[model samples]
Target: MAIYSSAVFPPSQLWDYAVKLYNNPEVSAACLRLQDRRGLDVNMLLFSVWVAASGRGRLTDAEMIAGIEAGARWQADVVAPLRHVRRYLKGDIAPADNRLAAELGRGISDSELFAEHMELQFLNEILTRPATGSFGAAERGEAAADNLAAYLGHVTRDISRDDLSDLLQIWQQAFPGADPRLTGLFGPSLQ
Candidate 1:
């Protein structure tokens, strides 16, 4: 299951953004919270952020549906099972050979990452690049908020204040230099 082939899933800006954002401990924690608690697709969440942060603009309903549908299929078929198995491997239920279980867990983790990369590639395919015009931080920030809100709306209407804080963390981390006021724009739907 471990195939170190870049050709399988070529590098993409979405993947790069996801890596950089996820590297931030706060952002990563927020993302996992959204994933574990809300059952939101983290890849789709990242895709929403990338779409706005990269100046591609807000996702249209069609594009949003495309991303959601694609992510759901891949996540259900590949990523989720990999994650389940990886968690199982790390659990006390695994064999007494902790070292071997740890090694196998690493391989599963790599495979999970590869699956995520592929998911990002599929998401990247849904993007429609806008015209060659400047999109300032303000505009990007607003779009990021909208994108995140829209994605969250589709997943669950039960967004809490804590969820908003996590969402804000993700948005701010996505555009750290953006307006401090941008955080207020994230969840008008929830408000």
Candidate 2:
């Protein structure tokens, strides 16, 4: 425990963003549903959001959390989800509907569902790509080439970008060949 604690770093905007990102009705619902059906924790749930968002491009934890909570891919997840969202976006995919979609939108198959996931896929792919800088601030560029690339390595390298998110990575890395989406919500505007 002490060794791990020594490794712990101060929380950044990224961590705060990650918290807010996951702390929402949709993500909460997704976590809840996953928990209800199979029991998940805050950390595991957060990891899921990370994968979904990272697929898009470089995302701060916040952007990823927001996208997941919204049930859209993380803005941090990348541009792919954004593109997906643009496709599924319509006149009424507002916040409440988005939330409802997240709640009621789980595991149902339909053309609408397929299209929505695809949009999110774009979001996921873009998120996993890589953010050039930090939150547009010059002070916090990633440390160096090796470190930066290692970080992006986690962001990329999934068959589906969502798999790049933390939990799936662990699941696949540890267990190999597991279902990333044993559960989650639907709709372009998930949160």
* Candidate-wise lDDT, in order: 0.83, 0.36
Worst lDDT window (10 residues) for model 1?
A: 182-191
True-structure RMSD, every candidate = 2.5, 19.2
lDDT of 1 by residue, 1-191 (tens): 56566575666878888889989999999999989988889888888988878878789988998899889999999999999999999878634688888888999999898888888998999876753447887888888888887887777878787888788888888888776464445535344
- Give RMSD (Å) of candidate 2 vs. truth: 19.2
Query: Which parts of model 1 have CA positions greater than 4 angstroms off?
Result: 94-96, 130-133, 180-184, 187-191
Per-model TM-score versus the true fold: 0.89, 0.25
Q: Per-residue alpha-carbon lDDT of model 2 for 126-182, expressed as tens digits?
A: 344454433311112212111222333434442223322333333223222433333
lDDT of 1 at 63: 92
Residue 158 in model 1: lDDT: 80
